[model samples]
Target: MSEYFNTQALALSKSFADAAFKAHTLAVEGLERVTNLNLKALETNVAATVDFLSEAAEVRDFDSLKTIFPKGVNLVKDSAEKFYANGQEVFGVTVKTGEALSQIAKGSFEVANDSFKKQVSAAQADFSKQVNGAAKKATR
Candidate 1:
């Protein structure tokens, strides 16, 4: 009886540990993806800023100013579009990670519940057998 209990306990512990590890791995991967996306965005922003500054510095007359103004407007529009796209990518990663974590939790719960039901059924059968044996001996 003790051995059976010990085995069940070990199985339950291992299941919990495995689920936790999976969750941790998913979370770390999601974070890494987001970090990479942000880094790339930052690099692009810096390069764009430097290029725009270089162009603006060369302005020496109205003709140069006219050309720089249109380029500056285009730069702002492009930057906004890039920012929106990066935000969507981050959100996608977050949603996927959350779904994976939820699946882990659901699977763990189902395993534990099934184990509990089996243990209860076994205990009930053992108790019934003992009771029947005691009644027969008393009658004899």
Candidate 2:
């Protein structure tokens, strides 16, 4: 029955491959969900941070520039939301987006990786449980 064994082995290989493919697809979809949620959250945080800093940067001096030609930006009257660089002042709210974008980009990458792994593990576990249930029923 060597031929029989060979046929069984081939079938087993194909089945295993199919299972793995399905698992991968499920994992990827789950990862996307996690990414979407986190991305939305980050976008909100960025927007909020920009608004907060815009109202406070003049006091914080975040632009890293704004001392040489201090002719226009009056620190006292301007809304507390201002940033400067090289002694040059700018709208603090504008630059906060770039910083927020960077943070979200980096954080999203890490978060996606972690979520992918967790989802893969969960998919595999669920697949194994179903397979085991079938085997148990067949044996019974």
Candidate 3:
């Protein structure tokens, strides 16, 4: 009986450990996705800013300034679109991570519930056998 209980306890501990590891792995992957998206956005913005500044620096006369005005407008429009696309991708990754986490939680809960039920049934059967043997010995 003691050995049976010990084995069950160890199995439960292992199950919990496995679940925690899986959760941590999912979180780290999600963090990496977000970090990569942010870095890409930052790089895009920096490049656009540098180009704008370079153009502005060359505008020494009215004609040069007029030439850069349209370019500046186009740069702004392009940057806005890039930012919007990056934001949408990040949002999609976040949603996918959320769904993955939910599935992990549900799977873990179901496994634990099933293990607990099996352990309980086994313990009940062992107790009944022990009781019957004790009663028979007492009568003899």
RMSD of each: 2.2, 17.1, 2.0
TM-score of each: 0.85, 0.41, 0.86
Local distance difference test, each candidate: 0.90, 0.51, 0.88
Please name the candidate that would achieve the greatest lDDT relative to the true structure. 1
User: Model 1 clash pairs?
Assistant: none
Query: What are the per-residue Cα lDDT tens digits for candidate 3 across 1-140?
Result: 78667877787788878888998899899989999999989898899889899879978999998999998899899889988999999999999988998888888878877887888789889999999999999999
Candidate 2 to truth, TM: 0.41
How accurate locally is residue 102 in candidate 1, as Cα lDDT from 0 to 100? 99
In model 3, the Cα lDDT at residue 136 comes to 100
Predicted structure 1: clash tally = 0
Q: What is the full ranking by lDDT, best candidate first? A: 1, 3, 2
- Model 3 lDDT, full chain set: 0.88
| Predicted candidate 2 versus true structure: per-residue lDDT over 1-140, tens digit per residue | 34434654565556556555655665565556556655655565566566555655555453534441242244322322322121122223224434554554555455555555665676677779989999999999
- Clash tally, candidates in order: 0, 14, 0
Q: Please report how far candidate 2 places residue 34 from its true position, in Å.
A: 1.1
